[model samples]
Target: MVRQETDVTLRRCTECRGYAYGGGPACAVCRDLVDGLVEGAWAVFLRQWDTVAGGDQERALAEMVAAEPDRHDWRIVDAAFDRLVCPDCGGRLARGPVGCPACDLAHGFRYAAIETDRPGVPPGNEHAIRVNVSVVRRPQVTSESEVLVRRLLLPLLLAGFLPTTEAAQRMSALMKKSPPGRRAQLVEQAVEGLAEEFSRTRRAARAAASSPTSPDTPAATRHRSARGRPR
Candidate 1:
């Protein structure tokens, strides 16, 4: 009888408790799932594992983490930190690739990495910043309603040029407090004054062209325009 070689699929990391895909020595899923949610992510995974696999799995996970605290990479803060809380389900996400399959099908994580110029620097000099991010399953935008609404409303909201209801009322009150003329009447008066000045300028220019060239033409009648216009 000839001995034949048997093909076998290797399991995922037994220590990290990842599903086996027969690709690597460690949990390939865990290694690949670098969304940046440091230790809190591992805690969530362990907690879930504990709930599903019972006390034994929990003990194993605890021991593994205790041996290597950096596995989770979650900074143990003295105070409560701001976490992404689901508005619909009120489920808290632990910074990395995670999802509630019941509420959502997306499995994602969030985390930060130290991309240092000098990796061998001392702890004091190692510059690292916490960057928060989200990775979600792409959702379909079925309508152009959002774009339409934004385009219509954004201009009105910005640049205090247009009067809102309250603003209109305020302006009305201010005009009422002013002495004598109505706002429209005042605007009309200003317009009439501008028309008169423009007519006078044209008449003067015509007269100057018809008349002989003089040494002084009284500097072309230096009449000003209006407020918000150059003098």
Candidate 2:
């Protein structure tokens, strides 16, 4: 069995307006922000993903990693096998210990061993009507492609060209809804969506870096260090 990284929360750093977890201070990128600027969102924490081993997605990532571990610069990326989302906003969702009340909102049914009371049956018959119900989460019911586009593609586009498990979900969703002849169209759309964001982020930094007059490069222009701070 492969060991896994200690789980961490996913919080949005106020300074950088980027996601950060693995607590301490606001990540390096946003350290300049005042303390407590880092805000945590359960939805983000739950839906956000990271690379892991021995879970369902491990086999798939392992195959790719073994085939070309060197092809990618990073040792790991998000490899999520499961997907969940917020029912209200369709924003990336996080999971938490669910109480009876909360469970009703998140799941269409409740996981419970229920005893049935029959109107016509005598009281003694109630014992025979016990049942177990497996409640599933309320589905978004949107096309998989739409989920992929919003959860994965949108973030990459806005924040730059980073890829994560959310992107994979988006792509998988697209594969399901795409028409037979137009499948490539969905793929290209995903790429284009990512590219658009990458372009903007790169351009902002480029312009700042190239300018000779600026006394200090803007925070957004600098590259993030391993700890998420600007170098």
Number of the top TM-score candidate: 2
* Residue 26's lDDT in candidate 2: 23
Q: Each candidate's root-mean-square deviation in Å?
A: 28.0, 22.9
lDDT by residue for model 1 over 1-231, one digit each (tens)?
Answer: 111121212223355542222111133443333222234444556565554334555545544533343333323210011223344456442322234442242111222322222232223221121211111111112122222222222112111112245643654464455454454344334333433454465467658765534334445753446689964
For candidate 2, which ten residues in a row score worst on lDDT?
Answer: 129-138
What's the TM-score of every candidate structure? Answer: 0.17, 0.26
